[model samples]
Each structure stands twice: as C-alpha cells, then as structure tokens.
Target chain A: MLTVLVDGVASGMLLFVLACGLSVTLGLMNFVNLAHGAFGMAGGYLCVVLLNQHGVPFIPAVAAAALFAAALGFVLERTLYRQLYGRDHLDQVLFSIGLVFVMSAVVDWLMGARQQLITLPAWLQGRWDFGFMTVGVYRAFLIAVCGAIVLALHLGLVRTRFGARLRAAVDDAVVARGLGIPVTRIFGVTFALGSGLAGLGGALGVEVLGLDPTFPLKFMVYFLIVVAVGGANTIVGPFLAALLLGVVDVAGKYYVPQVGAFVIYTAMVVLLLVKPHGLLARGAAR
Target chain B: MSAALRFALQALFWGGWAGAYFALPEYLPLLAQIAIIALFVLSLDLLVGYAGFVTLGHAAFFGLGAYAAGILAQQGWGEPISGLLFGAAVAALVGLLTAPLVLRGGDLTGLMVTLGIAMMLFEAANRMAWLTGGADGLQGVEMWEIFGVWRFDLFGRTAFVYSLTVLFLLYLLARLIVSSPFGLALRGIKGNRRRMEALGTPVRARLVAVYTLSAAYAGIAGALLAQTTQFVSLDVLDFHRSADALLMLVLGGMGSLYGAMLGAIVFMVAHHALSELTPQFWQFWIGIALIALAIAGRGGMLGLAGRLLARWGGR
Candidate 1:
C-alpha cells in the first residue's frame, strides 16, 4: 500500500512537469495547442536515441534533449505559432492537431513502430528496501528531482524579473506592451521555456510512461486533465491536481482492472460539472 | 445561396457523382466511403461552423451510431434503412443526455467534457467484451437487402448508390434546417452569444436542440459506414476519427453544406492516394497541407471555390 502511494507520487510529479506548460499556455494566452504533447514525444525520442544509440549518459542526454526541443520550439514559434496568436481557438486546435499527426508520422518514419527504452545508471537502477516497505531507487530519485524543480519554479516565478514579465505579458499583453515589456519577445521566450519543460518531462518520463510515436495521442488526456481539473495558469493548482490524479489513476488501474480508464474520466466529468473552471480556480464571478 | 446557384450546385453535384459512378465503377467502395465522410462532416458543420462549438469528441456520436446499428444488424433486425434510423436515434439520445454538460461550460471546458465523455465511452466499449466484442470489435454484423430489393453485392454498386442517395437526401434536409429560423438563431448565437442572450433567445435550449440534431445526422453517417462495410470497429470512436473529420470540414469550408462534400471528396482521395504510396508517412504530407491551409488559406478549398463562383457568376 505504501509503495503504491509512493509510486503514485512519483508519477504525479512527472505529470506536473509535462502539464504545467499546457496549463500556463491555456490559461494565460487562451491558446489551445493540442500538439504540445508532440514536443514531449520528440524530447523522449531524442533522449532515448542519445542514451541507447549514442551511448551518452542519462542526465546530460536529458539536458541536451530539453535544449533541442527548446530550439525547435523557438523556430516553430517564430514561423508557425506567431501566425496563430490571433486566430480563433478552433483554428489553433485544428492547426495544432495537424502538427501532431505530422509529427507522429515523421517519428514513425524515423523510428519504427517499436517502443523505445533506456538504461538507467547503476545508482538509479536498484530498489531501496526498508524493513516494512520497499520502493524503487529510481522512484525516490524522481521524487527528489521533481520536488526541487517545483520549488525552484515557484520561487523563480514569484521573485525573478523574467517571471514577473512573463506573468504580466500573460495577464494582459497589450497593457504590458504599453509598459515597454517587450511582450512579443517575452511570449516567445516563455513559450520556448514551456516547450523545454515538456521536453525535460518527456526525457524523464520515458521509463514510466513508455516512449512511442503515438505518445502524444496516448497521454494527451493525462496532460489535459492536469491542466483542466487543476486550475489552468496557476502553479500550485496543477501540482496538487497532478498528485491526486496520479494517485487515483494508478490505484484505479490496479484495483479495478475491469473498469480501466473509465473511472478517471467519469470523475473528471463530475468534477467539471461541479466546478467548471477547475477544482482550484477562483469563483467565476469575473 | 441564390436559387440559380443552388440549382447549379445540385446539378453539378448529382451530375458529377452519377457520371463518375458510370465511368469508374471500380472506385465505388472509395467513393461510398467519401460520401459517408461528407455526411459526417456536414454534421460537424452544423455544430462548429454554424453553432459555434469546437468539439474534439464528435466521434462519440459517430461510434454510438455505428455500435447501435452493428448490434441491431447482428441481432437480426437487418433492414438497412431502419437500422440507420435506429442508430441515429441512439446517437441523438446520447447527445441529448449529455447536452447539458456541454452547455454548462465555455470552449475549453466544453472540449474537455466532450473528450472525457468520449474517452469514458471508449474505455467502456474496450472493456465490455460481452457486448462491444472488446478490442476485436463487434463481429457477425450482417445486413438485409435494402427495401427487400437491392442486395449488397460484391461489386459494391448498391452500396455506392445507397450511400450517395442517402447523402443527397440528408443534404436536402440539412439545407432546409440550416435555412430555417432556428438555424438563423444558431448563427446569431455563434456571432454574439451575449447579444442573443440579451435579446431573450433561449440560448442553451437552442444549442441543445442543434447539438441533438447534429448528433442524429452523425449517427446516420456512422450507420451508413457500418451498413456499407458490414463491420463496426472501435476505430469509429478513435481520436484520429474525430480529428480527421475536423480536418475534412476545415479543408472544405465552414458554413456551407456543399463545402463539406467538396472537402470530404478531396481529402479522402488525397489520403487514399498518399497512404497507398507510403502508409506511415502520409501524415507528413497531410500535416504540410494543413499548415499550408492555415498559413495560406483559412477559408479552405471550398471557400476559395465559392469566391471563384461568385466572381465568375458576376461576370
């Protein structure tokens, strides 16, 4: 029981990392980029190829994968995403979905339909056995890494100038532009950072979630759940939501193999009915 | 559309399809698939183009219709037309039951709810091996002769004509409904929800009505696919199915019934040709097409055709 809960916490942290970008983008910019998962898949593939084919170490490969995704994201932002900033939500959704299909197919051609796996370092590969309960060493490492990231992200967003600029740009682009905030550049950098974060999450999550060309379509619901059920644009909301969801989903699949993913989806529908904005969103009085 | 334009459109459509049937009998199966797809896209147009709802789980209704008809046919109630009607009713009932949840939220919430409903149903169909046939899908779905006369021959001629005729008739009904006052209200709501609400329009009720109507059409389309193909797979409820339908609608043009037809024909033909060459990589080309469509032409192929039609007609 303790192991299951601990495993859930680890999975939830990975989900938060993958989903935070989407929530912030959805809430702040009102842009529904469905292809967000495509970048994560790219990062996953990149990391796996690096580790498996090129014989690179794990941590360095993850860092490089994040950078590669961020660069790709920057280019896409300049050429494609900029054009879509003012389009309808429907157009954005459709356009991003198209990107997803294209990316999926591209990945399929590049890598066969087989799933990609990576080897963990010696220290992160074994289990840490306690007298009463045992947990995987990798799981403990993930919790520590993700916890530090969450703390850093929270502090950075609250204290840093770049974070303040990002928040301002998100809250009201026009007013922020009037205040000489370089809004467009801020948006570009922020979007790239978000993409990079998704990439990092993907690199880290390949073991837990499995890496495949269909990664985006398969795990899209989880990312969206974290964003929607947790409040969009808020840091802590998705964090807590991801933890709760990760626990519920893992436990549900374990206990009720018959129902599979149905229960989580039902919970989402009911939750949305009671609180349309999100579980943590302020009253929709505005 | 003007009466002259409308008449010309119908003549061109029927004439083109009928002529194509006689010319390329071998392509009947593909053309029939295209026609069913057109009906599906038309249903989406009623919601997205006219009613201002951008959904990601429109396949929920399509799958319901397919499963309903598939189950009916397997149980020996195999009359094709009645099966289609029953399937449509099932889809409409599902849509009616879920309409309130859809109506309660804005676009993001709407997207999530529809997606959630679809995923839940998908998982339900996947797990219930007793009813939905599990992952292998429902088998033994046989259909009776259409109106007790035209049997579905191996040549697929009856299937082609049946689907095209069904599509034509449904198009007429859709044209009538969209031109009606209720459709006018839907358009008004799409343009300005706040203003419509201020004008005392029953916004939510109208939305529910249109959504239900659209689901019925989608169910009929799904039923047509199952009846013509004699199979019902879980792929009917797939995310790709919904996404592909959305792509087809956009490729055609929104707010025009004929756009759905034109878009469906073009997209399906291209997809068929491309997938034949490189099944796995066709998405690369489609993605490029979508990107081009977004960057160069948001109105889509049909929208451009409409512009040409107006210019030529004026001349």
Candidate 2:
C-alpha cells in the first residue's frame, strides 16, 4: 500500500509538472487551448531524437527539449495564438483542435507512426528498497525533480514581480492593462513557460507514459482533467488535483482492471457538475 | 424568396437527388453516406447553432443509437423502421438523462462534462465486450427489408432511398420546429438566457426539449448508417465522429438546415476523394482547412456565397 501511494505521488508529481502550464493558461487567459498536449508531444519526440539519434545525454536532452518547445510556443503565440486571444471559446476549441490534428499528422509523418524509445542513464535505472516498501529509482528521481519544479513555480508566481503582474492580469486583464502592465508580453512569456514545462514533463514522462504519434490525443483528457479539477488558474490547485487524479488512476487500474478509465471520466463529469469553477476558484461562476 | 419560388427551389433541390439516383448509380453508396452525415450535421446545428450549446461529445448519442439498433438486429428483430425508431428513442432517453449535467456548467465545464460522459460511455462499451463485441464491433447485424419489400442491396440503392427519405422528413421536421414558438424561445435563450427567462419562457425546458430532439435526429442518422451498412463499430462512438460532425456543421453554416446538408455533402465528398489519394495525410489537409476556416470566418461556404451575392447586388 505504501509502495502504491509512493508510486501514485510520483506519477502525480509528473502530471503536475506536465499540466501546470495548461492550468495557468486556462485560468489566467481563459483560453481553451486543446492543443497543449501537442506541445508535450513535441518535447517528448525531441527528447527521444536527441537521446537516440544524436547520442546526447539525458539531462541536456531534456533541457533542450524544454527549450525547443518553449521556443515553439513563443513563436506560435506571437504569430498564430495572438490572432485568437479574444475569440470565443468555440473558436478557440476548433482552432486548437485543428492545431492538434496538424501536429499529430506531422509527427506521424516524421516518426513513421511508431512509439519512440528513451534510454535513461545507468544511475536512473533499477529499484530502491526501503524497510517498509520499495520504489523505482526513476520514479523517485521524478518526484524529487518535479517537487522542486513545483516549489520553484510557486515561488516564481508568488515572490517575483513577473508573478505579481501575472496574478493581477489573471484577476482582471482590463484593469491590469489600464495600469500599464504589459499584459500581452506577460501572456506570451507565460504561454512559453507553460509550454516549456509541458515539454519538460513530456521528456520526463516518455519513459512512463510512452511516446507516440497519438500522444497528444491520448493524454489530452488527463491534462484537461487536471486543469478543470484543480480550478483554472492557480498553481497549487492543479498540483493537488493532479496528485488526486494520479492516485485515483493508479489505484483504479490496479484494483479494477476491468472497468478501465471509466472511473476517472465518470468522476470528472460528477466533479464538474458539482463544482464547475473547480475546488479552488475564487471568482463568481462564469 | 417568395413562397412559390421557395417551393420550386425545394423541389429542385430534392429533384437533384432523384436525378442523381438515376444518373450516378455507381456513387449511390457514397451518396447514402453523405445523406446520413448531413442528417447528423443537421442535428448538431440544432444544438450548436440554434440552442447555442457547443458540445464535443455528441457522438455519445450517435453511438448509443447505433449500438441499440445493431444489437436489436443482431438479436433477430431485424425490422428496419422500428429499429430506427428504437435507436432514436434510446439516444433521446440518454440525452434527456444527461441534459441536466450538461446544462449545469458553463461552456468549458459543459465541454469537459459532455466529453467525460462520452468517454465513460466509450469505456463502458469497450469493457462490455460480450454485448458490444468490444473493439471488433457488433457483428452479424442483419437488417430486414423496409416495409416487407425493397431489400437492401449491395449497390446501396435501397440504402440511398431509405437514408434520403429519412433525411428529407427530418429536415422538414427540423424546419418546422425551428420556426415554432419553442424554437424562437430557444433562439432567444441562446441570445440572452436572462431575457428569455424574463419573457416568461421556460428556458430550461425549451433547451431540454430541443436537446432531446437533436439527439433523436442524430440517433436516426446513426440508425440509418447501421441499417444500411448492416454493421456497427466502436468508431461510431469515437471523438472523431463528434469533431467531424461539428466541422461539417460549421462548413455548411450554423443554424441553416440547407447549409448543413450542403456542408455534409462537401465535407464527405472531399473526405472520400482525399482519402483515396493520400490516405495517410488526409487528416493534415482537413486540419489545414479547419484552421483556415476558423481564422477566416465562421460563416462557411453559404456565408461566403451570401456575401458574394450581396456584393454583386450592390454593384
């Protein structure tokens, strides 16, 4: 049981790392970016390519993956996403879904529709045993790294000037703009940051989650669930939600193999019905 | 635009189908598929365009209808018309049950809830392989002749006739409903919920009624496909089904029934042609079209035509 809990926590940390950017973007910008997983897919594939083909080491490959996705996010935001900032949610959905399809097809073309393999370093391999329980070394590393990211992100959002500006913009974009805050620039930077985090998570998660052409479509729901259940904009909200989801998912699969993902999807529908604004949202219901 | 001219145009529009039945006998299967898709898109228009509920899990109803009909047929009750009605009823019942959950949330919440419900249904269907045949799909679905005559042929002549007739009847019904007091109230609710409620309209009731009706229409479409093909697959419940239906509705013009049909024809025809040419990359082109359409405008083909006509008239 303790081992399961640890595994769940590890998976949850990974999910938070993967989905926190999506939560922030959805909450702050009120944008429905369904294509966020495509960015993760991009990062996952980049990490795979860097490690397998280029013989690059794992850590630097993961960093490069984050940078590459961040740069892609930055460019896409300025050119394409900018045009869609104020569009209706339906439009945003259609546009983002379109991006997902395009990206999926592109990946399929480049990668031959096969799952990519990631080779971890020797130290990251094998399992560690304690007196009470045993845990995978890689999963422990994931928890440590992702917990650090969450802490850094929390501090970045709370302590930094940029974080304060972001919080204000999330509160009210119009008022923030009136106060001469570079709301647009903040959005761009945040979008890039979010995409970068997704990339980093994707690179890390490829080992556990598997990397393939359909990665975006397959995992889109989990990311959305994290964002929605976490309450849109807050960092910690998604963190908690992701942990709950990870635990529930791992436990569900382990306990009731026959039911599959029905439990999670049903829980999400029930949760959304009960708390549409999510558990942590502070504003009036939209 | 006069009543007589409208009548004439309508006759000509359907007349074109009859003409194609004789003229393009080889393409009857494709035509039948297009007709079914058009009906599906029309149902989506009722929800997205008329009622202003943007959903991404409409396939839940479609799949429910298909499975219900397919299982009934596979179980030895292969009567065609009743099977269609049964499928529609099952879908409508499910839609009615889920309507409150869908209406409880805002747009994003609605999207997620509906999607979640659909995914749950998909998972349930996948798990219940004994009944649903799992991923292999429900097989041996033998649809009987329509009204004791005119057996379904491999050439799809019967399928085309059955699908087109269903489409026409439903299209007419949809037109009647949209012009009714209930439909007007739905439009009002879509425009402003508070105002509609203040105007003494039971906004929730109207929405529920229309949503149920839309589900029934989608059910009918799914039933027609199942009956014609004599099979049902899990693809009937897939996300792509909902996404494609939404795309077709947008392509034709939201809230416009005729535009819905036209869009279905165009999209399916393009799909048929494109897939044959570049099967692997077909989705890429569709993605490009969707992005361009979203970026360009929401008016779709009919909107563009209307704009061009206005420009010419102004000139």
Candidate 3:
C-alpha cells in the first residue's frame, strides 16, 4: 500500500507538470486549448531524438526540449492563438482539437507511428531496495524533478512581479489593461512558459507515460481531468488534484485491474457533481 | 423563411438527396456510411445548435447503441428496425441518467462531464471482456433482410437503400419535432436561458428531453452502422468519433437542420479525397480546415455559402 502511494505520488507529480500548462490556459486565460498535449509529445520526441541521434546528455536534453517547445509555443501564441482569444468556448474546443489532430498526423508522418524511447543514465534507471518496499529509481528521480518544478511554479506565481501581472490579467483583462499591464504580452509569455513545462514533463515522462505520436489523443482526457478537477487558474489546486488522482489511478490498477481506467473517471464525475466550480475557486485564483 | 418557402426548400433538399440513389451506384457503401453519419451529425446539431450545449462525449450514446444492436443480433434478435429502436431506447435511458450533471454546469463544465461519462463508458466496455468481447470487438453479429424481401447484398445495394430510407424517416420525425412549440422553446433557451426561464419554462426538463432525444437519434445512427457492418468496436465510443461528428456539424454550419446534411456530405468527401491522396497524413489538412473554420468570421461551409447566396440574391 505504501509502495502504491509512493508510485502514485511520482505519477501525480508528472501529471501535474504535463497538465499545469492547460490549467493556466484553461482557467486563467479562459482558452480551451486541447492541443496542450501536442507540445508534450513534441518535447518527448525532442528528448528522444537528442538522446538517441545526437548522444546528448539526458538532463540537458530535457531542458533543451523544454526550451525548444517554449520557443515553438511562443511563435504559435503570437501568430495563431491571438486570433482565437475572442472566440467562444465551443470554437476554442474545436480549434484546439483540430490542432491536436494536425500535430498528431504531422508527427506520425515525420517520426513514424512507433513509440519513441529515451536512454536514461544508469544511476537514474536502477531500482532502489528499501526493505519492505522496492521503488524504481526513475520514479524517485521523477518525483524530485517534478517536485522542484511545482515548488518553483508556486513561488514564482506567488512572489514574483511577472506572476502578479499575469494574475491581474487573469482576474480581469480589461481592468489589468487599464492598470497599464501589457495583457497580451503577459498572456503570450505565460502561455509559452506553460508549454515549456509540458515539454519538460514530457521529457521526464518517457518511461512512465510513454512517448508516441498519438500521445495527445491518448492522454488528452487525463490532462483535461486535472484542469477540470483542479479548478484552473491556480497551481496548488491542480497539484493537489493531480496527486489525489494519481494515487487513485495507480491504486486502482494495483488492487483491482478488472475495473481498470474507469475508476478515475468515475471519481472525477462525482467530484465535479459536488463542486461544479471546482475544489478551490477564488482563493486559488486570487 | 415562411411555411411555404420552408416546405419547398425541404422538398428540394431531401428530394435531391433521394435522387442520388440512381446516380451513385458505385459508391453505395460509402453512401450508406454518409447516411448514418448525417443522422449522427443531425443529433449533434440539435444538442449544440438548438440547445446551446457543447458536448465532447456524444459518442457514448453512439457506442451504446452500436453495442446494443450487436449484442441483440448475436443473441439471435437480428431484425434491423427493432434493433435500431432498442439501441435508441438504451441510449435515451443513459442520456436521461447523465443529462442532470450536464445541466448543472456551464459550457465548459458540461464538456468535462460528458467527456468523463463517455470515458467511463469506454473503460467499462474495454474492461468487461466477457460481455463486450474486449479488444477483439463484439463480433458474430448476424443481420437479416429488410422486411423479408430486400436482402443485404455483397455490393451494399440493400444497405444503402435501407440506410437512406431510415435517414429520411428519422429526418421527417426530427423536422416535426423541431417545428413544434417545444422546439421553439429550445431555441428560446439557447438564445437566452434566463429569458426562457423568466417566461415559465421548465428549463432543466426541456434540456434533458432534447438531450435524450438527440441521444436516441445518435443511438439509431450507431445501430445502423453496427447492422450494416455486422460488428461493434471500441472505436465507436472513442473521443475521435465525437470530435469528428462535431467537426462535421461545424463544417456544415450550426443551428440549422440542413447544415447537418451538408456538413456530413462535405466532411465525408473531404476525408475520402484527402486520405486517398495522402492516407497517413490526411488529418493535417483536416486540422488546418478546423483551425480556419474557427478563425473564420462566422460558422462553417454553409455559413459561407449562405453569405454568397444572399449576396447573389441581393444583386
């Protein structure tokens, strides 16, 4: 049971890294961008190619993949996403889904439809035997990496000047604009940063989540679940939700493999029924 | 816009649709699929266009209907029309159960709820190997002749005619329902829910009714697909199914009945042509089209065609 919990926490942290970008874009920016996973897939492939083809170090490759994805996201935000801000939620959903399909097809053609693998360093790949519970070394590394990302995100959003401006923009774009904040530029930067985190998450998650051309389609609902259950706009809400969900999902598979993936979705629906606005509404937003 | 003009337009539209029977003999199977997909899109049009509800899991009902039909056939109840109706009834029941959750939230919440419900169903069907046949799909579904006279043929001639007839009947039923006062109330609710509520509408009940009805329509479409193919797969309930249906609705135009038909036809042709040209990468073009459609000033292909037609008329 303790082992399951440990594994779940590691899984949850990875999900948080992948889904936080969506949380901010959906909750803060009010944009239903389902293509968020596409960036994650991009980062995963980027890391794999860097590791396999170029013999780059694993840790630096992950960082490089994140930077590359962030650059790509910045270009998209400036060129394409700006046009979609004024549209309704329905349009946004369809638009992002379309973007996902396009990215999936393009990647499938470019990289072949097979799953991509990254060679982890020997130390990071070993299993650590700790008496009653033997945990995967990779999971421990994931938990650490993702925990640092979450901490940095929490502090950056709570304490920094840029985070304040972004929060103001999320609270009320028009009012924030009146207060002399560059709302569009802030939105663009935040969007790129979110995409970068998704890339980093993807690079870290090749072992746990698996890297594939259809990663977006396969994991789109999981990302959405984090956003929906977490209530968007806040890093902590999704962080907690992801942890809870990750535990539930991992435990479900560990204990009762019969019900399979249904348990997490059932839990999500019940949670949504109780709190339509989400677990943390205004406090996290503020 | 008037009753007479509406009648004439409907006649021309459906008449042309039926006229294709003798015109496109080589593509009967494809035409049958188009018929089923058009019905599916029509159901979505009611939920999305008339009721202003955005769903990402409409394929749940579609899969339910398909499975229901396939199971019935496997159990030796292979009658076509009855199988379709049974599938629809099951779907309506599921819709009734799930619509309350949908009504509680706004558009985004509703999307999440519907999607969650669909995913739950997908997982259920996937895990229940004994009942659903698991990844191998629900097979051994043996179908029978239509009305004991016209038998299903190797070339899909019977399938095309049967599906088209079903489509026409369902379209007529849908037209009557949409033209009723209840349909007007749905439109009013879509336009402004608060205003409709202020005027003494049982808003939740009406939404549930329409949602259930739409599910039934989708279910029948799924049943049709199952009967025509004699199999049911997990893909029937996939998010891709729902997304493609939505794409068809958007491409055709929303809020209009004929838009569903137009969207289905255009989407089918586009998918077929693009896949033929570059099978592995066709979705790229579809994605580009979706982005373009969303960024466009208005709605879909029908919307653009409407503007051009109006411009021509004014001239």
Candidate 4:
C-alpha cells in the first residue's frame, strides 16, 4: 500500500507538470492548445539525443532540452499562435492540430519512429531502502524535484511583480493595457514558462514512458482529460485532479487489468456529466 | 449563331473532359476511388460547415459500414446492392442511437463525447476478436457481379464504373438536400441555435437528422471501399482516419460540395507526391500546408479560385 502511494504520487507529479502548463495557457489565453504534447515529445527526444548521442551529462541535458523547447515555443507563438489569439475556437483547434502533425512528422523523420530508452545516471539509479518500504531513488528524486518546482511556481505566481502583472492581464487585458502593463510581452513570457514546464515534464517522463513519435498524440488526450476535469484556471484544481487520476489509474491497472486503461476517461465523463463547468467551474466562470 | 456556337464549344470541352475519364478502362478505378473519398469529405462538410459541429468520430460510421458489409459478405450475402444497403442501414442505426447524447453538449463536450465513443468502438473492435477478426481484420469479401453483367475483376474495371455512378448520384442528392428547407433550418441552427429553437425549429431533431444523413453517406462510402478493396480492417475506425477526413473537409472549404472534392483531390495528390518524394516527412509537409492554409488562405482552394476569377474578370 505504501509502495502504491509512493508510485501514485510520482505519477501524479508527472501529470501535474503537464497539466499545470495546460491549465495556465487555457486559463489566461482561453486557447485550447492541443499541440502542447508535441513540446513534451520534442523535449524527451532532445534529451535522449543529447545524452545518448552527444555524451552529455543528465542534468545539463535536461536543462538544454527545456531551453530548446522554450525557444520552439517562443517561435511558434510569434509566428503561428499570435494570429490565432482572438480567433474562433474551431480555427485555433484546426491550426493546432495541423501543428501536431507537423511536429510529430519532423520528430519521426529525424528519429526513425522507434522508441528511445532513457536511463538515469549512476547517482540517480539506486534505491533507498526504508524500514517499511524500498523506493527508487530516481522516482523519489522526480517527486521531490516536481514538488519543489510546484512550490516555486506557487510562490512566483502569488508573491512576485510578474505574477501580479500576469494576474492583472489575465483578469482583463484591456485594463492592464490601460494601466501601462506590457500585456503582449507578458503573454509571450507566460506561454514560454508554461511550455518550458511541459518540456521538463517530458524529459523526466522519458524514463517512465519511453520516447516515441506517437507519444504526444496518445498521451495528450489524458492530459486534456485532466485539464478538462480539473478547473482550467485554478492551479490547485489541476493538482487535485492529477492526484485523483494518478491514483485511479495506478489502482485500476493493479485491480482491474481489463478496464484499467479506460478509467481516466470514464472518470472524466462522469465528472463532466455531474458538473459541466468542471470541478471548480472554470469554464462557467470564464 | 455565334452565341449558340460558343455554348456548344464550352459544352463539348467539359463533356469531353468528363467522358474521357469515365470511359477509359484504366482510369475508371482511380476515378471511382476519388469519388468515394469525395463522398467521405462531403459527409464531414455537412457537420463542420452546415451544422457547426466539429466531430472527430465520423470514422465510426464509416468503419461500422465497412464492417457491416464485410460481415454480411462473410455470412454469404455477396450481392452488391444488398451489401451497400446493409452497410447504410447499420451505420444509420448507430448514428441515430448516438446523436442524442452527442448533440446535447457544447462544442468541447461534443468533441470529447465523440472521441470517447470512437475510442470505445476502436477498443471493442480490438477486443472482440471473434466479431471483428481482432487486429487482423475481416478479409476475403467476394463481391458479386453487378446486374449479372460486369464482374468485379482484379483489375477494378467494374468497381470503378460502379463507384463513379454511385458518387455522381450521391452528389446530386447531397446538393438537393443542402438547398432544401431542411438545409436552411440547419443553416439557421448553425447561425443561432437559441433563436431557432425559440422560433420552433426543433433544433435538436434537425441536428440528429442531419447527423444521421451524413452517417448514411459515410456508410455508403465505406461499403464502396470494402467492395472495391475486398477487405475490411480495423484501421477504418482509427482516429487518424477521422482526422484525415476532417482535414480534407476544412482544406476544401466548409458548406461547399465541390470544395470537398477539390480539397480531396489537392490533398490526395499532395500526399501521393510527397510520400513518393520523402515518405518519412510527408506528414510534416502536409502539416505545413495545413498551417499555411489556415494562416494565409482562410477559404481554402475554392476561396482562392473565387478570388482569382474575380481578379481576372475585373481585368
């Protein structure tokens, strides 16, 4: 039971990393960015390339992957997403779907469509034997790192000038503009931060999920399910949803092998039926 | 005399173009395939264009039709007409059953529901190996000769002519439906559902009808595919198939039947050419095309054509 709890928390942390970015972007921009998973895939592939091919160390490889993904996000926002900022939801969806195909194809072309294995370095490879339970060092490290990032993000959002400006802009862009805040730059910066977090998640998740060309397309639905079931704009909502989903998924797979893969979607449907505005009514409030 | 002569000349040119493709033995099968794809895209256009319903599960109907036809053939129902009828009937039944649940929600709700339904069908197809032949799919579907005259040979000579005729007939039917009062009601629903409902348009029932009609079209297309290919695979119900159909409809421009055809032609041509050139990177090229079109060409190929014609007329 303790092992399951630990495993569930680790999985939940990974989900939170993906869901938080989706929630932030969806909350502020009201743009359903389906292409977010592509960044994750790209980051994972980049980390694998850096570590396996270029002989880079682990930490630097992850950092480099995050930076690269952020840069791509920056370019994408400037070139394609800028035009779609205030467009209809259908156009945004189609454009992002197109981007998914393009990004996945590029990665598949370069990486040859095979799943790449990512192994942790020696320092992170061992297991810690607790008196009650033995835990993977890597998994424990991932949980710790993700938790720290979440704490840092919470602090940054609640207790910083940038966070204040972001809140103001998200509340009303026109009002922020009236107050002489650089709303456009803030939007770009926020998008980059969200995308960077997704990259980090992808890089770390490689050890757990492996790297494949179709990974983004397959895993994206689950992330969106989380974002949709949780309140899109609320930070704590995703955290709650992620933990709930992670536990359900792990427990379902262990307990009911046949229907395990479908538990998340079923849960999402039930949640939506009961509360169409999500658990916290983000869509309704918006 | 001069006006009559010009009309005759133009008629001759277009008639020759259409006739050459239809009559040629080798080109018949290709033409037929194009027609089937055009019908598939047209079905999508009705939802995306006329009804403003963005669905990613349209392939469920198509795949169901294919499996229906395949199962019937396996059970010794090899007659072509009955096979097509059976496929359409099964698809329409499924679509009608699912329409109420699908149409009650908002845009995002509808999308997720359809997606979930499609995934369920896909998983069921994989799991029920006895019924759907599992992942291997149902093969060896032998089609009977049309009216006891033309055998569907391996060369596809008969299949091509039959599919072309079916496509032309369906095109006319779709055009008529889109121009009818019911079609106007759909347009009204698309523009403003609340107002239409207040005006007593029975918006939900109308949407369900249109959804069923579109499913029937998809079913026919799928039956034709199974008949022509002599096999049915689980890939028919895949998400990518639905995505491709959506892409074709959008690329062609919504609410335009000819646009769907034009979009399919352009997309298929590009896919064939790009895949031949760089098979691994073809999706990237297609994606680039889609993004470029979305950014630059709002109305798609038809829109571009209209603009060019206007420019030339002005000159």
TM-score, candidate 4, is 0.91
**Candidate 3 docking class:** medium
Expressed as tens digits, the lDDT of each residue in B256-288 for candidate 1 is: 888877888988998888776876677777777
Q: Candidate 4 DockQ category?
A: medium
Q: Write the per-residue lDDT of candidate 4 for residues B1-315, one digit (tens) a residue.
A: 257864786467336537856576665666667777877888888877888788878898889888899888877878988898899999899999889777764667667667767776777777677888878988778888888778898667777778767877888898899899999998998899899999999988899999999888899889988888888899988888887877787788777887887787677766755666776577787677667766774677777767776788688
The 10-residue segment with the lowest total lDDT in model 4 chain B: B9-18
Models sorted by DockQ, best on top: 3, 2, 1, 4
**Number of the predicted model whose TM-score against the real structure is largest:** 2
Residue range B233-315, candidate 3, lDDT tens digits: 99999988899999899989998888988899989977877766765567887788788888874467778877876788689
**Candidate 1: which docking quality band?**
medium
Instruction: Output the better candidate (1/3) by lDDT.
Output: 3
- Of models 2 and 4, which has the larger TM-score? 2
In terms of lDDT, the poorest run of 10 residues in model 1 chain A is A277-286
TM-score for candidate 1, please give it. Answer: 0.97
Number of colliding residue pairs in model 2: 0
User: For every candidate, how close is chain A to the native chain A in TM-score?
Assistant: 0.96, 0.98, 0.96, 0.95
Better of 3 and 4 by lDDT: 3
